[model samples]
Target: MPPETPANFWGDMPEEEYYTSQGVKNTQSYFETPNGKLFTQSFLPLNQTVKATVYMTHGYGSDTGWLFQKICINFATWGYAVFAADLLGHGRSDGLRCYLGDMETIAGSSLSFFLHIRNSEPYKTLPAFLFGESMGGATAMLMYFQSPPDAWTGLIFSAPLFVMPENMKPSKVRLFMYGMLFGIADTWAAMPDNKMVGKAIKDPEKLKIIASNPRRYTGKPRVGTMRELARVCQYIQDSFEKVTAPFLTVHGTSDGVTCPTSSKLLYEKAASEDKCLKIYDGMYHSLIQGEPDENANLVLKDMREWIDERVERYGSKNL
Candidate 1:
């Protein structure tokens, strides 16, 4: 953020005013999961007919608030009801900050709230999609795998962590050393700090804004977090062929965090005949939020078109 920027990413305007100015209604609440309480937010168009429902998940160390909601607000403005939650160990939710010991349990906690809203009135009948970015991409896929058949109409992934880039991958030797501790070092923040924010973001100004998020975890990757991600990422890649839902996976060729190759793998391996993949020539990992307005808008446009067609093809229960 610039020196003149307010504590809030959107400036001194009240949150409601800020969201209203963005042409969306924003509501915040606490969701009780079997594991713990989660800070949740829902965004919806004020006067437009709801087209479809989208359950979104934010990247690691990021919450549903802050600059992350840029994606949610954009979707809501496009007539989709967007719902997101801070993961179990991140943001204002319970547990140690950014400590993801068990990927399955963490995914389950967030999926609980999503299923509740998805099955509830007004939204249950509507076509629904799962959206995720960065590490959340893997989490969202896990939710999809665990979800009942036909529970989701489609899937969307942005710079998913299905394949780990050389530099971003945690050291196998280090993880093995930690593993020798027998669950002792699982929560320790001793893993290498990859300076991911610097790499994942392309715009310097947006980097400052994302770095300013008070809820963002800036510490070194936790021992268990990296270990589990390594394991689960492979698990996700192995399950790619089982993905039968219509889906769109996008990646920026220049992304320094997650590799675009993994996204291509999903497109190549997935069983969905309707699956689509778009590889942007020179975008960053945070395609929708970290890129310049023009670039971000381009990505959003593709997303809008893809989703509108999916809703039309599948038919929304709302209609």
Candidate 2:
């Protein structure tokens, strides 16, 4: 079982915590991509005079609603027009949950939506930023590296998965042995020894809040998800030098899933001129909730400040 009592992530969002009007203002609607497939959730502010707009992409096996409603509302309060959408396999989107069909499909749809929003009238020249967490962070990096220069004003990554924890590093000889005996060792080799499952957050209240929501925990990972993760990790490792956008990366020192050292290595390796890395002490993988929310909030506030500075210096004409 996946831990009977973990910390509450959303803080009392026990089932039926539907999107509230105060934060998410019922502007949620779906729009079609060039490929003729309709994705879900294009939320705009009821009051559209926000200084900037933030387009967020969610992680694997996760949807836009519930998971990001709190974050979205917080950003909206900070004078941002936020738009968040469920990725291919998750939520109401048309795809298999917890699986990867085509990585390009996921990345392309996001790029298309971003372009559509950027080209629209009011938001046309606004300073826009991309914020992602965990798997979403990985996707945001991929999208940033692949897009043209100035695609985003800046990027805020919360515990990006540049690499899985070092403990998961199997001996090459062991992998060879498994391959020889099994013909082909499955990529879905279960990490029974990996204690990352329920260890993501350290607080009990936050875990309860997260668990109470159904969209947060839906299905188990597929072989395809693992394969895609490997591919993206490899891509990031190989092309860290290709990244040019300003980046603000945050991770927890006590993270059980993606190691904090991974963020260190990524920060050291990226070629961006402006980069900041903040590691929260005693923080688990999920920094948004759990104890030490203050530290994470400071980090996010600093991210917005950094983004504002970059926008002022670089300006929308450049980004």
Pairs that collide, model 1? 1-208, 1-209
lDDT of 2 at 7: 28
RMSD of each: 1.9, 4.7
lDDT of 1: 0.91
Q: How accurate is candidate 2 locally (lDDT)?
A: 0.67
Worst 10 residues of 2 by lDDT: 183-192
Model 1: lowest-lDDT 10 consecutive positions: 1-10
Which residue runs does candidate 2 get wrong by more than 4 Å? 1-24, 34-39, 42-48, 167-197
Q: What TM-score would candidate 1 get against the native? A: 0.97
Give Cα-based local distance difference scores for all models. Answer: 0.91, 0.67
- For model 1, residues 1-319, the per-residue Cα lDDT tens digits are 5465465797888988888999999998999988999889999999899989999999989988889899999999999999999999998899899999898999999999999999998898999999999999999999998898889999999888898788878898998899999999999999988888888888899988999887889899999998899899899989999999999999999998999997999999999989999999989899988998998999999999999999999996543
